[model samples]
Target: MQPISRRTVLAGASALVAGPALARADRWARVVAAARRYDQLHAILVAHRGRTVVAEAFRGDGLDAPANVKSVSKSIVALLLGAAIDRGVVPSVEARLAEVAPRLIPTDAEPQVYELTLQDLVTLRAGLERTSGSNYGAWIASDNWVADALSRPFVAEPGGRMLYSTGSFHVLGAALAEASGRDLLTLTRDWLGDPLGIQVPPWTRDPQGYYMGGNQMALSPRAMLRIGNLMRRGGRWQDARILPRAWVEACLTPVTTSPYSGLGYGYGWFVTQTSAGRLGLARGYGGQIIAVAPDAEAVVAITSDPTQPARSGGYFGDLLSLIAEEVLAAT
Candidate 1:
């Protein structure tokens, strides 16, 4: 065999290191080009193997500007519940609503409402009439949000099919507040924002002064990316164990299925089987998404116009296709 020159050896080693980096750059460039097609999108951030590889802002808000995350707040709230459990603020998922926040229950609430558990509320299986969609205005307009949610007639048995009610989560926030002797914002800041090193700006509050649970929270795209990365890392950040690994794993396990998109509903995430991996998505109104693909060790955060709808048949579907085809494929 011929002896190789020192210059030749150095060139070969450099190529070996640069090859994957160049490929990643090429793939993300394609992703950015495809993302521009959607006028609603504000930003897209992707992190691979625990480091940010791509961050782009196309319009509207800048990548670091806080934008309304809408129902993605529900996912964050769910994490708070897990943290509460870990801290012994609340007992466990099996704890009954009436047991924890008995005063919040309305006088006329159905008998089954008292039996509703933490798991039921987090999973949207509380069986209460939905306070989302067309009924949202009236529910929010009510004199007392927590009472209104509990007083709603039972549309199904507790722990039945998913009802997709924001009211359930609102009631949950109230209960957590009552149980912990701390408000939702305080809990969020202490448990999540401080740990993840992200800002948690105050959002909408109900008539009784409880922070809205399932909607209207604000976080920058970068903040959302940190959250996704925390989840991707099994609820840890650096040296700190921000969330229990078991709790994070539980959040990934399917507890129910969403009726709207046919995706499995975990603690606060929507579960889906994709070619790249088992995707756990924290979705919101408009096109906001924080997707964690554990199999690929990839986390993607997307923010869009909060005022517009991103239904399954429209813009949201396009976002999913973009993640699966370009983002995950690159991983």
Candidate 2:
């Protein structure tokens, strides 16, 4: 037998790394084929074990182009809340909303407002009458979004029912700013974007200068995948624990059940059961999704324009399930 040469040794090491790469490429080809078959997908990205298993941007968009994540912004806000809690700058979620935003409370406040807690907002059990559906556009366009949100009549007792409210999330953003004595965008940038190497654009701000917390945030598909991967890894990135493990667990637990889809909502994430198993995801309008399947050790992020009348189903959900069934199963 011929003795092994240095070149042969280097070739063997390269193949070891290339082995996974080639396998991933094959898996991605299937995902791309599925996306093409579906017809509305603009982008799809998949990651496993913190590695990019597949990334493809269809429909002429590049990876760097920012796509509006709509409600995925809510999950990012939840992370900010966790970071604030971990730093001891804010007290527990039990803290009264009146204590955090005294201005929003009427001087002769209703008893329900006094009883409301930060936890209520996070859990979507705030009991305020929600303007979350058709009225959202007008509500967001109002001159005083926070005040307008607060003006909504109370439908039930505080913490009594699960009412999906974008207004509630906006209030949470305001509360965080009040408790930490910093603007929401600055705090988010310093605590999250800078640390994670994410480039969050200057998001639309309310008339009061608070970042629009409930919706209309932009992120690259890769950034969305990164956030999902972080959640999959239990709030740690590589060696650093960026968020509290306990808090992350709490974020994944179901706090309220969704009337629209029957899935459960926790903090900002959505908990649902798939054919494969239980999973957590952040879904946004127009088919943007950040799906984390912990059992499969996979995260898939997709951005697409599903609002088009021709393509008006849950394409993101369908595409993700297919990827889980086909590509992930192969691995």
Candidate 3:
């Protein structure tokens, strides 16, 4: 019989420890391979059953440093709204903007603007002309962002159409600040940053000092994945409740549909069917995203080029394909 060597015993123990980890990696190797294909892909992360399956950084400041997540901040804001409501800072989504923050309504603004609910704002149905895309420049460049947003001409009746507008969310952010007596920045850090152990860095502020909402948030891929996990796990993280489960459910459920992407729009999430089952997407400009598939017990986060547009079947669609075709399939 061979001598019982210490090195051999350690090797056997190491193999025992590595066995499960190696298997987990192998289970998602196809996803990792697919994620690595994009040159502009900043970072990609995937998790399953409360375990991290893949985390890779490519173009952005690695995984630890913050990358601008663009409009995915709207989803983060939605999470804060849930926490605020649970804490009684906000009465409900039905709270009218006029009652909550009457001062923000421009003097000559459309009467409907004064009646916009928090629901209307977060759901991008404020009925105001969009304050994003080409209009975003002038909107942000205004002297008073809140008033400027409120002053936009009505393109549809309040709650009539899903007009994607950052201004609506900006006003919502301001109202959230006034309601909670804390700026969106502080609320975000307290409600989400501390709970998830993720850094919520200071983002661009509006002219009136309100934290920019629905856009220009900085979160690392690791932090973004933490958020994704919080949502995928139904607003709980490690047994600590962050968001009301009900709010998370409603956000994941579709309330409207996007004309461009043909995806269902919930509060901050875009709902669509994928091979991975019913997937809810928290998307942003330039492809930043948090894709949560409850049925698959998986969450995937991606941060892409902040400067470029990621249209469907274009670069951003490739990111979705990575999740729909590869990650979900691998699972």
**lDDT of each prediction vs. the true structure?**
0.92, 0.78, 0.86
Q: Which candidate order results from sorting by lDDT in descending order?
A: 1, 3, 2
* lDDT by residue (tens digit), candidate 2, 1-331: 9999999999999999999978877877777777666666778888877788778887636566788877777778888888988898677778888876777665554577777888888877888878688878899888887777777778877776688888888888887888888888888788877767788887888988988877888888888887888888888877787888888778888877877667788877888776666678787776778888877788888887746422123665575566667656745
Q: What C-alpha RMSD separates each model from the true structure? A: 1.5, 3.9, 3.6
- TM-scores, each model vs. reference: 0.97, 0.87, 0.92
For residues 53-112, what per-residue lDDT tens digits would candidate 1 score against the true structure? 889999877999899999999999999999999989888999999888899888887888
lDDT of 3 at 148: 87
Off by over 4 Å in 3: 1-24
Rank by TM-score, highest first. 1, 3, 2
CA lDDT, candidate 2, residue 206: 90
Span of 10 residues, lowest total lDDT, candidate 2: 308-317
Candidate number with greatest lDDT: 1
Pairs with steric clashes in candidate 2: none
lDDT of 3 by residue, 1-331 (tens): 9899999999999999999878767868877777778877888888888788788886778878899999898888888888878998878899898888778788888777767898888888888888887898898888998898888888888877788888888888888899877899999999999989999889999877899988899998888888888888899999898888999998998888787888898887888998768898888888999999989999988988888889987987888888898888877
Clashing pairs in 3: none
